[model samples]
Target: MKHDIVIVGGGVPGLTLALALAQSTSLSVAVLEARDCVRLFKRDARVSAITQASKRIFKKLGVWSAIHAQAIQSFTRIECWDEAGNEIDFHCETLAMSALGYIVENQAIQFVLQEALQSYCTAQIFYSTKLIALHEKEDAIMLSTDTGQVFHAKLVVAADGAMSFVRERAQIILDKKDYNEEAIVATITTTAMHEQIARQCFLKTGPVALLPLSDSYRTSLVWTLPTAEAKQYMDLKPDDFCKALTCVFSKRFSEVVVVEGRQSFRLCKQQAQQCVKPRIALLGDALHTVHPLAGQGMNMGLLDAAALFEIIHTAIAHHRDFGSHAVLRRYARWRKADNFPMSVGIDWIKQLFAANTPVISLVRVSGLQILNRFPTIKNYFARYAVGERNGLPKLAQ
Candidate 1:
């Protein structure tokens, strides 16, 4: 089989890119997914905070309405504080937007994108198919799958995730940092209503975030802790876990009555040394991974997809090879400029908060207090958070 583009991994990024191209361009696209379509719809306890820019991208693809109909929790305010009693608050009113962002289940986004692709997309998706080897030729790249299928494409995209087979096969070096921490994720019903607000508390150990859900009393929790400490928390009974969590959260939510889908994963930051090579391009977690303290990972991946789509669309309009190094390099430079600084900023914030010394705490608290007092500066950060930065792709606008 041959196509103009082949995307490895049918996750949100790959599927979004495939759908975008299929809807707006004439490229013959294909997606290689290692799991069956039914498996993709299984309940994913994880949720993502979709930025305004990402929402617009989905809207352009004509699937945002379907996704919104399924499930969505819109939050207009964000409150973050430290143990020192210093807090910073952000409101959507600062940007004249109705909502700062929407929190949606990861599975919901994936299901909607997959359904849209299957129903009307010209692109083809192959389930139970995995890329085993890829070789780049002068005019096209050859991909071999575990199912003994061979595919040729003018361009190949690696959205397979952090442990990307395509990235490894391409020999892209990754700069990595292990924070020696694990993030405990769960869905909990609290005694107090979240009031459509997203909240985060910085503890001596790490940060814990409560993201508002559709239900007034339900929120998603992401608590970062040292690896060993995380295991101890995971081993506790649900009641005991809730008690400990409530204490650490300063009882802001009153009490965590029901905790479901409790799980933890190690935390790390990784960046590929190069995002593109000849006919191959990397996006999403394959290109970079950041601390989730800000809930920007999914949004970042969405932007990457949108940006790449715009670049390729322009190339095709000019009758240039979209897979050429010249065209791919443009994408690499564009994303690196936007993604690199954000990655570093998130990592820095994580490290700054992780330190609990009196002086360090004082400095951070003072910084938060100062920033909170200045609405203009706070609004600047708020704008960046909602993906209102300049140079956004047409889809995001």
Candidate 2:
């Protein structure tokens, strides 16, 4: 098959990019997915915190309505506190916004994206197809799949994730960092209603976030801790796990009980040394992976898709080669400027709270209190949190 663009992965970023391009231009697009289409719709235990800006992008792509129809929980109040008693709260009403953001199941987003691509976008989707080789020609890129299928495209997109085969074949080096911790996720029922508020508490070990769900008493848990501790939690019986979690979050909720499966993933930081090279560009986790403490991982990837689309559309309008290094580099530079600082900031926050020194702890507490004291500052942070503050792509606006 031949296409103007070939995306190496069919996850959110790749699918969003294809949808955005198809909706905005006449670019021929193809997505290579390693998993079966049916398996892609299976219920994903993980959920993502979608920012308002990302919601706008989805709306622009004509998929937000479908995603909204699925199970989603809007959080209007965000409360964060440290073990030292320093705390801050952000309410949507205070900012005159509908909600801070939303919590949607990962599978819900994928399902909707898949549906939108089929109904609204003309992009060809090849499932159960894995990239086996990538060859960059003088004017085009060629790809071979595990099934012996061959594809050619003017440009290649590496949305294959952190361990991107496309990126590896392209020989892009990643500046990686391991946190030596794991994030444990599960669904739990709380005696108290979440009240449409997202709560994050910084513990001595790590951060635990209880995100509101469609069910008022059913919340999603993302608990970050040392690798060994996370393993222990994952191995614990349901009742024992509830007891351990109750001890961790005893300050906020009561009678927490595990209601579903538990899973854990090792935490890490990865930023590709280059997001673009020759006729190829990286998107999503293929470009960067940040700590999940702030729930910005997927949001950032969505923004990348939006930004890349913005550049490519402009290039096409000018009759320029969208695969040219100049066009691809523009996308890389734009994302790095915004993504780099945010990654560093999240990393700093993770480290600051994890510090055990009394002085550092006092400083961290003081910082939170100061931010809480000033509504303007808190609102500024909120804007960024919803991905509407900084340089936003046209679609995001």
Candidate 3:
């Protein structure tokens, strides 16, 4: 089989890219996914905080409307505080925006993207198929699947995951840091309504985020803790876990009840030394992974898809080889510049907050208070968080 572009994952980023290419250009795109379609649709329980930039990209792809019609929670304000009583608030009104971002379940986004992809005749999804080998050619790339099938493409995308087989085969080095921390994710119902506000509280161990969901009384929880402590929390019965969560959260929500099963994942900050090699470009988790402190992981990946699409579109307009190293390097450079700082910054923030020493705690408290006093700085951060920035792709703009 032959295709203009072969994307080696069926996740949100990969599907988004395929749909964008099929909608905007004549490229024949194929997506190779290792899981069944049903499994892919129901895999992720976590919700993603979609930034304004990502929403715009989805709009351009004609899927945002469907996603909006589905269950999505929009939060206009984000309130963050520490155990020391220092608090910082970010409001969308201050920035003249309707909402900072929308919280959508990961599966919902995937379902919408997959459904949209079906309308494009140029895009094909191959589930239960995995890439087993890749070979770079002068004019094309050859890929072999676990099913003993062979395919060729002018370009291949490594959107598999953080542990990407394509990236490994390409010999891309990764700089990784294990924070030795784990994040506990669950859905909880609180006695108090969320009021369309996202709340996060920093504890001595780590930060806890209460993301507003569609239900006023339900919120998604992402609590970071040491690995061992996370295990203890995960092992607790539902009622006991809710009690502990209420206490740790300082009873701000009155009372909390775990409404869904809890899940935990290790927290790590990792970035590929390079995001491209010849005809192969990395996207999403294949390129970088950051701490979930700010919920920017999916946002970053979506922007990556947008940026790569723009670069390829421009290359096609100019009659340049979209898969050429020169063209792919533009994407690599663009995303690295944007992703590197975020990865480092989130890691720094995690480390800074994890330290509960007297001096560090005082510094944290003072920093939040001082930053809160300056609307200019806060607005700048809020803008960045909502994906308002210079050099954005045409789709996102």
lDDT of each: 0.90, 0.89, 0.88
Stretch of 10 with least lDDT, candidate 2: 36-45
Name the runs in model 2 displaced over 4 angstroms: 39-41
- Kindly list the per-residue Cα lDDT of model 2 for residues 1-397, writing each as its tens digit: 8999999888998999998887878888999999888434555569999999999999988888888878799999988887767788888998889999999998898888888788645587889997788898989999998788899999999999989999999999989999999999989998888999999999988999999999999999999999999988888889999998888778776779655868899999999998899899998999999988899999999999999999999999999999999889899889988888889989999999999898888788788878878889978877887886768889999
- Cα displacement (angstroms), candidate 2, residue 300, comes to 0.3
Please identify which of the two predictions, 1 or 2, would achieve the higher lDDT against the true structure.
1
Candidate 1 per-residue C-alpha lDDT over 1-397 given as tens digits, one digit per residue, 9 for 90 to 100? 9999999999899999999999989889999988888544555569999999999999999999999987799999998888777788888887799999999999899899988987655699898897788898989999998778999999999999999998998999999999899999999988889999999998888999999999899999999999999999999999999889888765465788889999899989999999999899999999888999999999889989999999999999999999999999999999988998788788878878888788877788777877878888879888987899998889999
lDDT of 3 by residue, 73-143 (tens): 99999988777677889898899999999999888888898888889899999999977888989899899
Which sections of candidate 1 miss by over 4 Å? 39-42
In model 2, which residue pairs have backbone atoms overlapping below 3 Å? Answer: none
TM-score of each: 0.97, 0.97, 0.97
Per candidate, the number of residue pairs that clash is 0, 0, 0
User: Alpha-carbon error at 48 in model 2, in Å?
Assistant: 0.4
lDDT of 1: 0.90
